[model samples]
Target: MNVETETMKNEAAPEIRIGGGVPVLGPRDTPVAEVVHACHSASIDQGLAALAIPGLNRETLEPVLQYCAGLRCVADNVSCPGCKRRTEAQGIETLDQFILSKKEVIVGDGRVRLKGEGTETVTTPCLETLSKQWSGENYWFWARRVIRKLRHGLRRAHMRGEPVAGEGETPSIILMEPQLADNIGMVARACANFGLDDLRLVSPRDGWPNEKARIAASGANYIIDDARAYGTLEESIADLNWVGATTARQRDLRKPVLTPEQAIVEMRKRISRGERCGVLFGRERNGLETSEVAVADAFIMIPVNSRFASLNLAQAVLLTGYEWMRSDAGRSLGRVTTYEKPLTEGLYLGRDRPATKEELLGLFEHLERELETNGFFNPAHRRSTVSQNLRTLLTRLNATEQEVRTLRGIVATLSQGKGRARKREE
Candidate 1:
């Protein structure tokens, strides 16, 4: 006699667990019924291999290939010899004969086996309701939802462990008063894309534990599940040792301003020294206010067209994350080296160390003194501008220690010539 078991609501659809693991039904949007029909449409003798009881179904068209792999083919019939012997030993008839006589069969567990028997139970777990749907209102919508849920479930079951962020010195992303759950989820996905995991939120407009965010996150639940929410911005970033505020507009603050590339270098430097760092992202509409910017130690500005500098919150986070990964990834960005032997390797490679600020400042003072004595600054009011111009010119060189000393020697020789001319005139 066939035994039937009641399936609980919101429970897993009946599935043949393969190798003690969840069965992979198929790829995303793979029709489950089609796979079942394909497996049973033709006889095994006609080059049709029956699917195994428990296995992944990547595509509904393929069904479960591993299922048929286990069955032994004998006399135009695909059957499990062991399973047939077990059931027959248990005083039951052949599995195929039993399936032909019964519509539903109950296994040892409470799970309802919709099809097959013995070692091969081809059953749909949580999709029992789909067996009744023929045609009606909102059928496709419900079908799509069910399919999506199944796809996610299959993916979850196949994974041996929860997905984690990549290993690196990724900075924490802090969202201040974020408005949309969609944006938050997108940001989490972007963070995952770049190996970033630490996500901190301050006063989200719709509050926390948002379902929409989880749905939007796709498969990056690790970030959403472990994301921290705080009441105020201060509380959110209180533990961070260094914070960089991302802003598009130029501010009058005295804090150091750096492009994304430069900011990542500094961030990496600090992280290497055992300091925790984070980036502050403002709301969607208006960016961080003056007070909020003041809390940050530095500013990170992405060089974009000034006319339209507005960037989506997720985009900004993605760009920053990309730069962070690129910083230490040893990725070459169009760096060129000479393939041929150089004529003058000494001059080019002699500069081993950069010139110290003090050395550069001393050179600047020495040159400025000689210039002042020679009346180079004719217009008294323009002295400051002239001095600034000279400093700017030197700053552009990024002179090395050797280069500074050489330049100082040149300046000293020129001063000596002027001194001799003045002495002769006297």
Candidate 2:
């Protein structure tokens, strides 16, 4: 009779706790099932090897590979020498072996084994459910997504693209209790300016998912659109093992609060070691509350004057982002040196011919009329002075043609007042 016992030791899964490497399955002769699980969960190289072979069903797949690594292999499809002749042979018939390449296969004959390399990779009909259909446009998109997923040894998405040294993985950012739309827009801009695209917002104040935020976001609309809104902070960061909070004031909890530099060091340490981490930025007015701070594994402080330590929500984001880039991680995450010259070859063909005299006069007339409407000209003040002041502000920015037009519209609206423009007496 086959040896059997209830509750056989399975040191394979994390469930088993044994000192000094004693096999969890008792004797070295423990069952194959327990042996397999132990080896698969151990590391990157071995786990994939197990997936490449057959025999263990998907259920037992993880466990058997976890333990059975470096164990003896079958010579033929049938029989192990340990199982003697004249006795029924227990062979693994479930091995649905596949070729790593078009040319080679790992095969075992009774008492003999051989290895051969495949010249070309075999095309097994795409087996996974989620694999996308191939298309020309997708070729580029998937390549970029794949690049985004890479963990190390490559130029990061934050930098200009490079030959694949490796891939960089973008981390997620979590915000708690946002009170203002401008702050949200600024945060969105910060995320886009850096490499972080995953934004999670919890319990927003006033109105969010509104037009005002979209307007403020400007070029960062995609980031704002992709942002995830949650009901609470804990739920927001639940998946992250390492959490950091930002604060400007003192609190009762003794949790370590680090300066932006120090926090980046700590967060960098964990990230390099493959820990999932998230940084929390609190509301605009009060910053993160004590309740929210309690759950954080660490705190990040922006060093500001004690008497005047307050910072706008977006300004804090800028500092944190700048620090994040200096972390050891920032180095490997694909930092590149921008050259003195532009990366592209040339500027637009018509970059600057300057508008004709007629165009310039027309622009000034439109602008003056717009300024006159928006209270840019006080009823009691010198109209020419007010108009000049308004002109100076726009001039300082060196407004582009398109931007000039948009500003004119806003001014025009102010001048015409909020009432609907009259429809032609229809």
TM-score of each: 0.43, 0.39
Residue by residue across 249-316, what tens digits does model 2's lDDT show? 78888888788788777766776787777789888767888898889988788878899988888788
Off by over 4 Å in 1: 1-147, 150-168, 330-426
Please give, for residues 85-139, the per-residue lDDT of candidate 1 as tens digits.
2234345444455444345554435364545434553333333322322111232
TM-score of 1: 0.43
lDDT (CA) per prediction: 0.65, 0.53
Predicted structure with the largest TM-score when compared to the true one? 1
Cα error, candidate 1, residue 192 (Å): 0.7
Candidate number achieving the greatest lDDT relative to the actual structure: 1
- Output the TM-score of candidate 2: 0.39
